[model samples]
Target: MNQDFQEAVRDTPGGTAEGQVAVVTGGANGLGEVIVRRLHSGGCRVAVADLDGHAATALAEELDGTRATARGYAADVSIRAALEQLLADVLADFHGVHILVNNAARTQAKPLLEITPDELDAVMAVNFNGMFNACQIFGAYLAEHGYGRIVNMASLAGQNGGTATGGHYASSKGAIISATKVFARELAPRGVTVNAVSPGPQDSPMVRSIVGEENLESYRRTIPVGRLGNPAFIAEMVALLASPDAASVTGACWDANGGLYMR
Candidate 1:
């Protein structure tokens, strides 16, 4: 190991992402919000895209009052045209793009059998269809540029069939895990890496609501780590995968489930 490089990382964490531009979907709140903050703090120019434009702008301005390093956009990824427009908008604003983070998703707690067709379609539109379109649109731009990084958000539910989040949500995530590999293999030759970060029971609002505040202790005890995962740490993992040093990590699904589900 290079002790000199280690010291430099300690002194300036953002050096790895310096000069890189990243677009994060669903970046207005929850896990997406934390990931945006982490990347921005690491010196990456971040474009915060979400359905909620107001919140996204607030976060961007909060990070950089002059809008030099960050900006927010309102986008619905389910629409292919919208994703294409998002690509154009980002390129116009940033002059170039390098990293994309797919963190936008919808979670429902309905029972497996009770999940209706309409409900499943709604979830898939946002989680699966949206992600698939992004991979195609952005992946193309990245391939044309000959370099890019895509980090998709997966869930432990996808691997274990889930206990609280609905079956549709699990299925969508499982699809994402598979898509990551497909995109990874195709983009590898083009100098682009597509990967995923699968998280389980986190200290996030979604998990809190699913497990209930009163039963939080019991939920913590069930996990092997005896605690919920930290969103900041998850963001760090996303940032790592987005960094230049992670070129060799394509097609990998880095798990952060606190030992809840392991390979």
Candidate 2:
């Protein structure tokens, strides 16, 4: 294998994304935050988009102290117009985008039967509609550019029907997994690779909020790794998937579920 491919597999701390431009949704906190940091550290110019503008700006300021490698924007991905504006702003600042990481999502742990229609709709708006908007907008941009990376954030719940999440959340993620393949096939011809990363229950703030400490520990005991996944673990996978070295890796859903949902 080539050294670059090996480096991508190992996810080393280097400029794998050197000079590239990337946009990450829900990048203000949790797994998205870690992904933004990792890509920036890999020498990529990153645009951090989130609903919480202040938090996003704070993170961007913290990471890009020099304000040269990263910028943050407040955006609601559920709104197609907002996403379009975000795309325009990112292009204006970064000139062009080479990577798009769809990491924004909402998680609820209610029982399937108890999940109300409103709850399902709200979750779908963010988890599914938001992702679709980004893919459609950025996916087109990448296709036009003739080369890019698109990493959609999925979950183990989608594949295994939610060990710790609800039906609404799981179903949305399942849709994302399916959409990844469709986009992958279509964009491949344009030199754009689309893929998804399905992480097991991680110790992210979202997961913690959904699954309390007691339940989290209970779930951890069931995993073969015996511990909840860390945000960095998921971030590493996004880093690899966003890197130029990952050009040949696409149209697949990567598993980082600590053996909880082995395929």
Candidate 3:
């Protein structure tokens, strides 16, 4: 297996997987990392899957040196074969998987008109295709197992054409929202739930880079809440949706955009 698919091995600060075995895509950095940590703290055995194998392993080791409850697997969500291998590796290491968080994504700051075809394809490959395939592959397995949770990382941009992010990113997320509903309906009867978390301008590196330090305060004022969203809180939303308690909720997009957009 490639290093990307290698299962390396985290400790639960507070959390069972059912035993709660969770595989978090793009779990090596940013919001995805936070979700990984949050789930681990909530007693879930976590598989920190990311493109950066070394970083994933480091985080996994930091969470659990013993590698009993936490581990890292490297994967490129855009590649079907890589994802398939990831599933096999995770199952081999964790025995059973109960949660799947589709957080892997790509974005560019290029303007819509200037956006090259290649750029759009690259973003969609990771943000949409990767997540969709994971749902199909993992959803089937979870349904077969008779229980599972799937929380996808959506964005307010998908609903409102995006702010600072690229056009391709927004389109990918919009597709994600639609697919979340479809998958939820398809898997609901099998004891599996599929949902999405859409966040607005968050206090994350990505947002910071997009908005820039000089314009951040001005941008915050445009938000109804007058502040950027918190990444940790967004992670909490993912955690809540992934919990067994949230079995009743599916095909829903929970928003945390600080009133940036409202239904």
Candidate 4:
């Protein structure tokens, strides 16, 4: 609920990678916002980019306070050119990017048979296409730098194919899992690690939007942990993956599903 609580629970005490610069897409809200805040608590300069320009600017200002290490940008990740410009702006502000969190995604809760062609396209454009663009563009930057960390946000639906997620959303996340592997394999040689975090129904607006408040009680009963996932917990995993200590961990999909879908 508060930044202080999130910061206190962090496993990395003095911060994961102090002085490092990170770029987080969809960083204005939900898990993305928590991730941005967690990273900042770890002493990393961050850039928060989101389609909601107002919210993004507000978040940036909240973090900026006295120091201006964190800045927000209004950009749609689905657009290739816009993402390119976002990378440029972040670079200009931070001077360099050492970590990238591909957290921007869109999803809906339509039945498999009810999903329209346009619906599939729209979800893919953000969930898959947007992630791809960021990886390729920022992946290039990380490669050139010969050192960087990339953490892609994935979901339980990607592995299970249902879990209340529509077919389009599930498929897009599955593709992201595969893409993470591809990026890891290609970028590892260049000293960049690409990993993904697949979390089960989180206690975030995104999950509430899809699952609805009325059904949350039933959903909780199904989770082995007896509760929905926490955004901060997910953020902690991202921080660990982004940290220098995780340099050897790549091409991996870390699960944070509360034993709901264990491998």
Tens digits of per-residue lDDT for model 4 on 60-172?
88998654678889989989999999989987877778889999988777888899999988999999999999999999987886788999999889998873778898999
C-alpha displacement of 41 in model 1, angstroms? 0.5
Candidate 2 Cα outliers beyond 4 Å, as residue runs? 1-15, 215-218
Give the whole-model CA lDDT for all candidates, comma-separated: 0.89, 0.86, 0.88, 0.87
Best lDDT goes to which candidate?
1
Residue 254 in model 3: lDDT: 98
lDDT of 1 at 5: 23
TM per model?
0.94, 0.91, 0.93, 0.91
- Taking every candidate in turn, the Cα RMSD to the unseen true structure, in Å, is 4.7, 4.4, 5.4, 5.8
| Residues 5-95, model 3: lDDT tens digits | 1221122232223357899999999998999998898778899999998999999999999999899988999998988989999999988
User: Per-residue error at 141 for model 4, in Å?
Assistant: 0.8
lDDT of 2 by residue, 20-39 (tens): 78899999988898999988
Error of 3 at 244 (Å): 1.0
lDDT: worst 10-residue window of model 1: 1-10
| Candidates in descending lDDT order | 1, 3, 4, 2
Residue 31, candidate 1: Cα error in Å is 0.6
lDDT of 4 at 253: 100
RMSD of 4: 5.8
